[model samples]
Target chain A: MTSRVIFPHKVLPYLLLVPQIAITLVFFYWPASQALRQSTLREDPFGLVTTFVGLGNFRQVLSDPDYIGSVQTTIIFSAATALIPMAIALVLAVMADKVIKGRGFYRTLMIWPYAVAPAIAGMLWLFLFNPTIGTFAYMLRRAGYDWDPLLNGNQAMLMIIMAAAWKQISYNFLFFVAGLQAIPKSLLEAAAVDGAREVKRFWTIVFPLLAPTSFFLLVVNTVYAFFDTFGIIHAVTSGGPGKATETLVYKVYNDGFVNLMLGSSAAQSVILMGIVIALTAIQFRYVERKVHYA
Target chain B: MPERTEAGTTSRSRRSPWVSHAVLIAGILIVVFPIYYTFVASTLSLQQILRPPLQLLPGSHFLDNYYEALFGGLGRVGGINVWTLLLNTSIVALSVAVGKIVISILSAYAIVFFRFPFRMTFFWVIFITLMLPVEVRILPTYKVMVDLGLIDTYTGLTLPLMASATATLLFRQFFMTIPGELLEAARVDGAGPWRFFFDFVLPLSKTNIAALFVILFIYGWTQYLWPLLVTNSNDMNTIIIALRKMISYADADTQWHLVMVTTIFAILPPVAVVVLMQRWFVKGLVETEK
Candidate 1:
């Protein structure tokens, strides 16, 4: 009787995963296959005409200047967005971990930006940086600096980066703070007893113990930078100031939806998917091994 | 643990609390100033908003801007009222939240309790989808929506998102941590699986469920790309999409005041959700990570 009961409990986990499995197959695998198929065909506004072009779309995208620019922009955007937020969040998390009072208030306010929709975040930034009416623009003009993100490529990229990082800092902070808290309090005390200063204690005790949390945040933050900021770019810049803000996914949205070049867009999507998958696999295999999961 | 230090030594060893407070205050301001600026900007008129020196105080145009953006004025492109858009967004978000939670619970139970074939294979496949970004499969998913006649409808907007792999994975992991003796005791008491799930399992799983609810609600509410593609008409547009339309129009005409107002309106719902759900939200992340 005990064995029979134990067997069902053991097997139950697998059975419960069925709907997720089915949904993944239908919505994920089926669509992925369809995207792959559509990328090979010649698609017009009216309909798609299927023909196996044997990497023609891929070749066209790889050689195209616009595609190349998008790839470059995406690399820069992802790197900056990921690195900046991680740095800021790490510092904030450490500070928050040290403080005792008003922790909840600080956390609540810090995560407020994350609550705003990305499109809304873009719109708010758009208003704040408006050339004529924007408060930031007014401050810049008063300080003898020309502030026009909409007109300058570099300014536009910087604004987008700032917005993305601001939105993400709270999320990363939450994870980091939690990770910091989970580190046994005794470790820090032990370090302090050994004549370690604050900075030395953090470097020797806290940082080493927080490796797993850091790794998880790194993966999550990278994925977010690569895939989630399309809406932000769409609202704020729309790949504007001469397409300077056109990251890979933003370009995919343009080619696929706005321009109705479905095949080429699908091709771009496939390439992006491949890159993300490869990066993720490499991250898990190489970086995760370094994570000290206590 | 170290020996207890004298009070003087312990107090002297710490940095000045005032300095830490100052740093914290500065960080908090940087995090919160945008929201403050947004609210202030929404209150100002277009001309004042555009003036060389930007207005810092709350302006007289707050009601005017709100009225215009919500009801159409100053050459605003008119469509559904703000109330209607909020209602639509709420309906879609609420339904998606409920559907996702229910499905996640059941699916999690099945996986946690039953003997099933190809279980690990199934789990791996589901895990892989968590890595697949929505942009990759959107084209075909959009086609599926059109094929099933779900476009321009609430059912269409919320259904595809309902069966969330993230929620399932989360719940399954949480369920696995529950004590096995509870299930055995329930079985001995002659409770069926359904009774066991409802009576015993669910009560203990409230924290996880609450966390999942907060996360899913935010995800559903903030969904923009899919809703934009499927719902073409203004009547069907959720707040996020509606806000996008407002910004696009403002971008074309350079109507700063109206844009600010619409942006404020767009942010209110998600902000409300976050404030209400913050506790669960953090708890969920901590649970999942652990």
Candidate 2:
């Protein structure tokens, strides 16, 4: 991992590393350790007292109906967030790949959404879905649907999903386009010689070739729905119409910052950290395997 | 990977161009429509926005709406000027981007150039942090910020976020590609590590640094949950958080016109960066993730 002509100086290297290490120790490791330690201890409502609860916090969080519901909500949220964006992105990317006209123009126009803040994405969609002033809400009501995200849990969940998915589409579209472009033109032509139509060619050849990228995107998208969509939920639904849209990350924020449940939130954070570590491990593993092939 | 495929090319040319263009145009419309509506809304009067059958075209109130949003008078948004929020956001974004690049490149240099005890240890410590996003550890991190009295400060907003592994990893990967012969030659010429780094390494790193700056600046700009937790005062709010405040949804009188104006202002800088620096943006994102 090091150069052959390495610096023999000990203190200089350590000094070079000190700033990053110091920041990591203080901000990352310290808080992480605090979360681990605090997960075993319960604190009273006032800033005064604490009691050792051992694994009680974990038990409480794991067994809570609300927390269980959040896990399910996160799964659904992540799945929809992953699937919808990837599907739409794949469709768009394939279509863009087929035609040569205005190729760069289409790409530049489509990816602007990637630059919009997730919170602002929520705001944009929220404006469109607001019952009173929302254009879509007006259309929905005109179509005789009882459409109010404010009062409807399902509608709130859908709103956040749409907003989150919208933000992610450009990112997925870029990757999918990249992945699609990497497939050798010969393969598609080879399939064409065998009488495979575009649909058959895509299913038998292109789809199989995109497996690695699709898998990588799946994990990344899951982690995103778990974490990055915090803005979308916060700005759009705030985890409500009665906790219906509270993903695991939002629950950590709500329980810790809003409700002042330290031990519980810490336990939840510990769990979330574990989940992320696992996800990152999977991503890196795929990356390494791809590197080996390359 | 280009092929002649004369027959294939002819057949593909005969394939329906209308269908692909139609689907692509539809996709573009979905992606661009929200942003277009935001622009359209920002140009309209509040009465026009709330009134039924809102005009799809840009209205005559564009200057007045933007002027009000930039100055003040966003009702229920706590008297914070858009200028103050923009300043806070730019400061935090710049600091995070610059801070991350500086510290990461140095540590990467240390790891790559020197052999020391616990060198692997330090590498793992930094590398492991790639997984721990701020959202995963907000509470304890917030408590630490509170204890250190960093809460509600620019330092709090930027510093904690700067302990990033992605930049360090990116720099490490870039550093590995620097031919060892350059360093050997520098040493034979009696150049010290600092001199060699400044003269040779830093110049080589310029493109990488610029690309990374484009990505990290956007990362810093788009942060929401961290700023939402850390900055309690209106004065400390970033434009994103301020927009959230302005459009709290619970508030009935959320001057939609003004909020739309602020939304446009909030996203324009980063979107401009991404569009203008498309090459660097793509390179930074793709390579860093890998």
Candidate 3:
């Protein structure tokens, strides 16, 4: 925000800006613009024809049962991925926050999963739950419960959800730990002196103080579930058994890359982009509310 | 709030510590389980994996599986060895990181320090790109890559992914914190923008550069859909895509041992970066989010 003393140079700044702008235009903007155009135009799979369809593509996508189902899948998937990770991370963070012993070691052991790619997370779980080869799946069968992610939609959804949530726990945990540390120790001590129990102190004081962090993680985890978990669905279930795990992002990939339905896919992309923009707006709005809370 | 001190040395005081430890230990186990499974599975033979309830502990096949994984034991994916896959991945990851840092730094410098027309416009342009990830624009971006004749090449793999709004914003924020007196001093010495940037600004940016490198490297290394779409040849395939191909386990005769070995290989570099540079990785992540 500071307007610092400027070193006088007209050409140099433009020169500095060129590479990033050029790359952005060529890669991000041009393609984004092309998606906007393509969304309004239907194209055959052969790559030879085009027809301007306007809202027809959007209409088709909105009315399609598959698209409707995918929207539902996305909501469920996003909520579980967001809530489960945040809940686990909050508990772990609270527990870890209690003691100083082995804190660094526990953090080191916990946070490395943030480095695992989404697809790799899917693969890791895929092997663990493989009907015959997977250790956990084998155990499930041994307990007299039928377990086949490959065949069952609920099981497949659960598999991808677990993988996605597992990968995200580290991220949320790190943030929650940071948030927990940011809380003033004096406040907790004051609460204790007032005869407030640990549970009472956490629920009344700590949890309220962590609202901003909780809300931030909620948006981030939701956005992640929407855009980033495509790899999980793509690898684990490929939206399979019966389109059980096909999130909106996965549907976008499948429509364009797999099925070659250009118009529909482009339309879906526009809708997704709009959703993200709205989510960003909501984040900013809630962040403003948190300023008052703090 | 995780603990409370009782004045009378009550019964609840001593028992609370154990509860916290128990919960923390249980969390650590669940977090470490999958990676541990991968390591243990890699140490076992194929027969062990085929049967249900594989050994929980490491088996006796470590060298055999890792040797196979590293030395082309898996089937020919685009006719490339697993070693080549590792090499390609490293190249893509490093190039994307370095490329992003360089361009983003330059752009951030321009936008932050110099007053220029359309500066705010350019900043907003970059900001909007954050909302449009590769997932949404895959079709058109793939077409552009095809048109540019970059498919399956290193340029194709890293270049498109290098245009980063986050890195630029990070640099811009960091540069703002540098005192304006430095710029005044440099200007009074008759140093030009280019000279001052190289001698003054970049030196201050070293830690940021390193931090961004760790974050971006992991990002590029773990990319699934983009690299999967662009790099059609196995010779050009990164470890992630190669691993995915290896484990279409339902249809193919997946060598579970070798697959596990490759999983470790795929995970090692980025995880190494995170663990080794834990301080900077955390700092960089928290800063970027802000």
lDDT of predicted model 2: 0.87
Worst 10 residues of 2 chain A by lDDT: A1-10
lDDT of 2 by residue, A1-294 (tens): 432787667799999899999999998888888888989999888968899999999999999999999999999999999989999999998888877778888888887988889999998888888898888898899899999999999999999999999999988888888888778787788788788888888899999988887888898898888898999998888999899999999999999888989999999999998999999999988988888645
Give the per-residue Cα lDDT of candidate 1 at B132: 67
- Ordered by TM-score, highest first, the candidates read 2, 3, 1
DockQ of each: 0.52, 0.70, 0.59
lDDT tens readout by residue for model 2, B115-169: 9889999999999888778887888888888999988899999998888798998
Q: Which residue pairs in candidate 2 collide?
A: none
Instruction: Tell me the spans in candidate 1 whose CA falls farther than 4 Å from its real position.
Output: A1-22, A43-49, A279-292, B1-13, B61-77, B251-255
Candidate fnat values, all: 0.58, 0.74, 0.72
- Stretches of candidate 2 off by over 4 Å are A1-3, B1-13, B73-75
- First chain TM-score in every candidate? 0.87, 0.97, 0.95
Report iRMS values in order: 3.6, 1.7, 2.9
> Which of 1 and 2 is ahead in DockQ?
2
Error of 1 at B114 (Å): 0.7
What does candidate 1's lDDT look like per residue over A228-289, in tens digits?
Answer: 88788988899988989999888888888788787798898899889778767866674447
lDDT of 3 by residue, A101-153 (tens): 78889989898789999999998998899997888998999899999988999
lDDT of 1 by residue, B1-290 (tens): 13323542353237865666667688888777787887888898777766646555787888888988777743443546777777888888888888889877887677667666676676677667765667876778888878889899988888777776677777877778777888788888888787888897899888888887777777778887878878987888887887777767664466777667766777777777787888888888666752
